[model samples]
Target: MRSSFKSSFGSQSTHRPHKMGYFSSRILPSEPSHFTKLYFDIAPGQLPIVYRDEYNVHFLGLEKLHPFDAAKWGHIFQYLKEAGVIDETAVVKPNEASDEDLSVVHTRQYLDSLKWSWNVAAIAEIPPLAVVPNFLVQSSYLRPMRFQTGGSVLAGKLAVEWGWAVNLGGGFHHCSAGRGQGFCPYADITLLVRCLLAHSPAVKRAMIVDLDAHQGNGHELDLGSCRNVYILDVYNSGIFPQDFKAKAGISRNVELRHYTQDDEYLNAVEENLEAALQEFHPDILVYNAGTDILEGDSLGLLSVSAEGIIRRDELVFTKARDHRVPIVMLTSGGYQKRTARIIADSILNLFNKGLISRTNRNVR
Candidate 1:
């Protein structure tokens, strides 16, 4: 006695057979067209230096210490190549920083001194082991530091254009406006940031994520008061350049206690970074991905392992991507045994994740 229309409205009658092919076509995903750019200092080995004391072992294996040593960084390229994650290329030579470019964050006096020293050293007959090498160690110092600073600036520009980019050498965070501190000859990050901000309209604001075991005291000083820049430094609390936190207002210095492990450190990063991102919705993110946090790092006081370091890179880069912020990365500070390869590998993992895609060709 049921009505004929009742059958038409039934679930069985209304349902159609699922088409496997159509379903698969709609759900399948294509490979992402993401890439990474790696900027390097090709002649880093040629930079002049005068060995003063027995501490020359610090610069041994000049090729390895070349700041942009491929042996250390080549693995990163190889990994990306093997994984088909990125199209890699080297930065061209004579990638020198102009005087105007250096002046953005450095004092004219310092720049002049650097130039005079290089000019004098080039002509001097001083011994390799001399203290000053008869070079005009003036108030203004520029030259090799410019190369690194310029390279990093270029990297930042490329990262903004692309999604990610890496500077094989940089993170000279200890350099300040008036003087160079620690091993930093120039405040590379400062100069680079200033250049990026002035040139790029897209980058209205930026955030620096410094994960070096040492505090980025100089960076805090240089960019602390700037309204557009936000800095988060995760380092050992009580070491080097004392009174850094007090001076640098924008910084969140996470002073790790000695013997801190992976979980504790990572948790701290997770907790603080969320707040920082909320507070500073930056247009660009710069990561000082230092490998000095490795378990047995000579200069690092923490006991983070190789895996821990990789996780650190993952956390920061992932957060950048999630927030849709372009990232510029630097190989900051890492002086453990076989420092180069270890640092390179850590960066490669991030490169392999399809970050840093601009090449020399794309850069203007």
Candidate 2:
């Protein structure tokens, strides 16, 4: 039997599936597995938005050394709450993914490597973390990633049942099964898609729509060879993780130059996505929505306006809805302090445009 937990939105749960037959009238997985605890029955009253405060990383001011926003997850939720887009009672809290949970995709050697602070410090790109004790690193950093990773896994299941789901934190596209980079310590995107394909009966083909400014070389290396997993990557050619070898994994690739602006970027996304969908229909869509593409984002090196980001999200959600494909959205790479507000605003735009809502449950 699968595990279950009850809690108010924004509230933490000790731990963390499905009814709409939304995934093809298939029965749930019955045998015991590492995924049982991650897949549970959720009440209809809850929205498929998964998050928890534990997703934030707080250390002895060490997190500030990295440009990435450590508190972006909490900020996004708080903004949504302040805007009345969500309440404490409406969202689903996720469990921290255990070592066993991560074992589904990550190599045992890679998992064991995290026991060393030096290794973790390298993965997080926070050189100062190397001197910190392993326990402190785990508690202050990796633990939070575990929770977001778990949220991504849970959101995959939720998306199939609810037609769509958003994990407020996640989109660790730079971590593969055996390696972690670009501040991504776990292959959450890989795990999410792998879980759905392995356990969800209806999901035979999954499409990853990665719009992060940097290439999603992590998941590309992990899932690229799978015939059933199609990837559409739109990234700046000049950015990090320019894994040329991983380019083979992308079923459709759209490369952008440095300082590429809205019209060209958005047009490429819309055109390639439309063409990709027409060529390879998927049972589920994993949208890696990264706010790092904003104009002033130094790391992203793109010139997309905040409104462009919103429109990009809207376009993805709208296409998914129009095509009747369930989508699971992940807040990927966004480095700026304002990235959180931009994410919240984009989500609000999604809500306002009726692209995402509780009422549009997959009840059929």
Candidate 3:
């Protein structure tokens, strides 16, 4: 079944069958969307990292209601600042993605669906947005998402140039091109990979390493087993968005049982990732490094400890670097207050271990 499904996924991209019914299964348009200033080169002093103050969603007391901290990005940046890893001037500030930039992946119909606050509320998993005025919701929630989406796209380009890049916000893997769901309002993952493939002749193949607690159905459906994309998703089996159909697209899918801890988790990751490297070589690696796998994350269900999460990230980056593959990492989930601290710590570990460095082609 897996082989046959894989063949179907490859064929659909070339054939473009009508009425596939899935939300994000539609192939994108041939032309690039606007090709705006997103391609601007970073200075030699700048880090291959992207973030902005607006990336945090804090319009009112509403953020307090949700378990996920919409303000997590800012907290992570602040911690990095105090730690001397990064500062305001050193980190790249991404431009907000304009509507045309989003159109590359989203259809007009799916984009229009966001007009109703009810739809947006469901997408963001924040019920209060349903009653908020659409205009206010747009500014408060959607605008922040657009900025993160832009960061993801820019990070993709930076990864192709530098060996690694990180977007402190993004990893909307649950939102595909035509639909938004699971706390993800935009198909940022799909857009990033598509943009890289379209613009860079050197970038032929890409790998999506989704370590998020929830299934990354959006990009799975969006790429639909496309020939060049190799998806390796390791998530809790007892979680949300159990899209059996989408599972067909994962080149290497590892679903863990509930409450699974460090030993079993690390073993699975190393064996599977090693096997993936042997089977396929991707030009770029997109790491959805969601910290929700932390032991206390209720939504994640699994019991991976703080040290485990840091080890997990280091393993991925080290292996990818050894194989000479560039990487783009996105902080997809795990917005608990502690998640920020954990992410910052893991990043620090990466730097200390000499796994990640701030260098430019200028230095080269």
Candidate 4:
């Protein structure tokens, strides 16, 4: 008997059948766990951007098979540097999230289950990874996810302090406390929310503006019922993880049809977001900015153009900033080769619009 929506696909999944069987019947952790200093002080010249080299996945060329650009973070970083906007000395380097940190949101049973290579392979959507040894999978695959998870947590704090922050990676919005799916291994978005709620007294209320091509069922499963979090999701009506159960939890929802173009997409975003802001004023906004909506993306079949995507980002940032709400942006679910370049362009647009700025923090 499948208990959740994810496990319901057990009979349907021909590729990897282990997804459902892996879900053990166990109680989730109830209390919050202590974590290390995922956040740090930034000196002059440092941008509130979070990234690290380990965020890239390069193992035996197996990552090439996936539609995703595993090293897209590196590409975005290089482009920014080439543009003379940022250098290695400026970006924030995040520490790998330890077991203690993850346990704050994930169950002990779920964490233990990831020790198997097959499990990690399933979450990563790479069939070749199932052959890799468990230890190697831990280091090569899961380690980078941990780093990105920590980056998301750190970005939450940076956004509150600096008024805005961006994690070059993360936005694992499809993984919840007890489950992982849609190439998302960790519940980083949930972790960031918990961190902010616990750390910042000013951030009493938060909003998740999920504009990904697909539904953010992971964070929806985790934070849906919480009164403190308001979710305004705009995703393709026809797509993966068609989680109607999760959709019921959204405070505001805009379901776009397949191949929806820029005008329709942008208009929906602006109107819905404006309405959400009017209904509930948040102390902070967490934007799941996925570039998968680019026209050529196989998985994200939406036809939003590169230029439209850039304008979309600018619109979101402008709204959040104008509302005096601290915001954190995460680069999620962009699969095509051009996704990284478009992302870089959008960040540049944000800077040009004065929505985000260089903090110029001194070297620590």
Candidate 5:
């Protein structure tokens, strides 16, 4: 018979250390356990951003996937291996998002526009421009926004089934029902949430905790009328997409001033998130853990540090654990020297600790 806790905490309890022996004896198959999937869509050979003028100080680093991201994720994988949290069979890969999947949250007109832009840019034989009028750059030279959107949906599904999953990219919260804006091709987070609602009965209620430097305006618009969804965005005020409005009364759109510190930021998160948790009582939490809040981040105006980021994750993860709600984490935005690794490590660390606690409980 399945353990009682198995139904409560989802599948994680089945792999608890004390239960491992029982699992191996009764349920373990001849086939090896699959490693947790980490989805990625960015091409490896993309060029770093460059500018002609010496005074321009181009963010060349932004062009290519940062080395630190891979390193941090690699470190986390190593830690998981040492702790036996994952098996050798774990794998990572790119996932494609279909038009049907995107239609769950986006209009067909917007989706076609993205494809049209890509084709037109190709036919014109012009290198992709990051900033273009009347066209949302879905596919940049470095990151294809569609791939990231698809990856988020794939990761969310995997997390539901396996107890945890991560998307190496995504956090494009600026896309809307009729249009895609703010460097995001599609509202990836919103799309994923819609997918969950369609496919998973376990996810009756969901709370989106967006900690990106920019406000999740698009998500607010897309999920505003969603009866069972709640959105809480903590972002800098007076930035892009000016004249912000919260259509959903449940939405808590807190705007911070420029140069906010780590403590101040986290305090806001703790306070607002606590309130949201009490009121919403969601079954699932989707966190847009953006690294842009880091002090050195190019676009982030906040002064949050690395340790601060960890604290934020801990607070949110602990809430999910206490509520016995599963979490789907998406990498929203991070544009520092080694932002990817830092973001990846932070997520892995959360899982590592959660696993350890479960193991300890089993032993006791």
Candidate 6:
């Protein structure tokens, strides 16, 4: 049966759909802004999944020096196509985020800082980028990130209107409004949350479910004081970015030990996530699904198998579906060469389990 959950507005871009009548509407923006281009409506036939070919970062083989698989986003999409889950036309392509759009969250000084190649290199943690020309750096690296940032913003609206959305290339959790680090240059998660709260009338309160291996200090720093936002972060305590100050922002914190296995890891997730849902009712859920915790990953320093990764994704999606909260998922941080395949498999598992669908059924 065709699901009754259709977008609140069609291709013309109107107010959020009638299905969101359950939540009281907030005040709409008095004047339209340039950021509206990022929230333009998608066709009903297109899935909420957002991706673009330009999302892959490639630059004179410099990207190979970094541990990150720069082309992972493209590879995931290819696998999904091979699995017959989606084709090129079925996916939603997002526009690149403009300076004005990014100003919604970033400081003007920080935005100006990126024009220097040295600054870009430092933020991306790639020393080679320091020697590269600024224009080349912009084209080969920063442009793709801008597109991914735009995807995150668009996916936020898509999730609210259609119940679920996935951006194939975002989750820059280490970058705050003023600083970028850990290979994350832009705070896409923060931008998404800010844009939604300002524009999506039905989404007054938002929840961030950050299951990444590293601490999500960036968003915590950005939204920590926000009473309307709830954060639940489950990460390896022994890993990088141990920001005690950022811990102040987390409503529910699960700090796992080094080399924690699947049973213990999954248990903590289930317990804390369930408790968090009971404590707060969110209109939208931002899920940072990072796969770096796989057993052999040297950086994440944990021991979750590929099967465990799949199960973990299922658990989160099931909880979101049961709660009827709109979800937008981001592929955060995972460095292994095989990480792409694991992500593809986990997403496929979600589809087979009926946790996500093109029609976005079973949502209020």
Clash count per candidate: 15, 2, 0, 7, 5, 1
Off by over 4 Å in 4: 1-35, 360-364
Give the Cα-based TM-score of candidate 5 against the true structure: 0.68
lDDT tens string, model 3, 270-360? Answer: 7767768777788889999998888878899889999999999999998888788889999999957899999999999989998878764
Give candidate 5 misplaced runs (Cα > 4 Å). Answer: 1-89, 92-94, 116-143, 246-250, 355-364
Candidate 1 regions exceeding 4 Å error are: 1-94, 115-143, 245-247, 355-364
Candidate 5 residue-wise lDDT, 1-120, digit = tens? 322232221111111112223222322122112221223232232111000111111123332333223233334345445655443344344444556556656777766665555443
lDDT of 2 at 277: 84
TM-score of 4: 0.90
Checking candidate 6 for backbone clashes, the offending pairs are 8-17
Residue ranges of candidate 3 with Cα displaced over 4 Å: 3-33, 361-364
Ranking the candidates on TM-score from highest down gives: 3, 6, 2, 4, 1, 5
| Model 4 residue pairs with clashes | 43-361, 43-362, 44-360, 44-361, 44-362, 45-360, 45-361
Cα lDDT computed for each candidate against the true fold: 0.58, 0.85, 0.83, 0.83, 0.57, 0.85
> What are the per-residue Cα lDDT tens digits for candidate 1 across 190-289?
7667666666667777788888888787877777656667778777664665554433433455667666678878876766676578767888888888
Q: Model 3: how large is the Cα RMSD against the reference? A: 5.7
Best by TM-score: 3
For lDDT, candidate 1 versus 6, the one ahead is: 6
List the candidates' TM-scores in order.
0.69, 0.90, 0.91, 0.90, 0.68, 0.90
